[model samples]
Target: MSAFRARPPAIPTTLVDDAVTRIIRWDFEPGADTGVHTHGLGYVVVPMTDCHFLIEEGDSAREAFVAQGAAYRREAGATHNVVNAGSEPMSFIEIEYKQAL
Candidate 1:
């Protein structure tokens, strides 16, 4: 059983959904949140602008800062709610690798 509750739908704009990967663009306002959710597929995030993130998972939370153009990847099954912690708005590109069906 999972400890986290379902999160609200993330604000995302799908740019590409091909056989290989799903690419999405996300724009977040200050204090906005991307509700708690678990990743089903491994993914990569490319920052379009510098970002400050408050990530909450289960009973714990932490903050992260990534500069523009810096990219990071995460494996599947990561669960968390991502919040915009900075004063300004931020945007990023997310690419999720599709799993074999």
Candidate 2:
């Protein structure tokens, strides 16, 4: 956990969890956030709708714009907080690989 205290948790629903991978769907209303945390497994994210994000990493902050269906991957051990910066709701699917990819 980092020093960021941004609140109103984003909703995450596990879609699949197995020996090979773990999948989840995350939904966020405007201003909702995924609190600062570390990822133990490498994962890919596919945006379900166009997304506008405010990303906070330790002492830094940034913006991200991802189109719907655009998928991206991140390495394990990354720690950050993601906030829905757009006025509209947004959602994405997260697929975490159990085995290194």
Best candidate (score: lDDT): 2
Model 1 whole-model lDDT (C-alpha atoms): 0.86
lDDT of 1 by residue, 11-98 (tens): 7899999998899998888887787789999999999989898899999999999999999998999999898888888899999988
State TM-scores per candidate. 0.86, 0.90
Model 2 lDDT tens row, 1-101: 57665567899999999888999999999999988789999999999999999999999999999999989998899899899999999999999999754
lDDT of 2: 0.92
In candidate 2, residue 34 scores what lDDT?
Answer: 86
The backbone clash count of each candidate, in order, is: 0, 0
lDDT of 1 at 57: 95
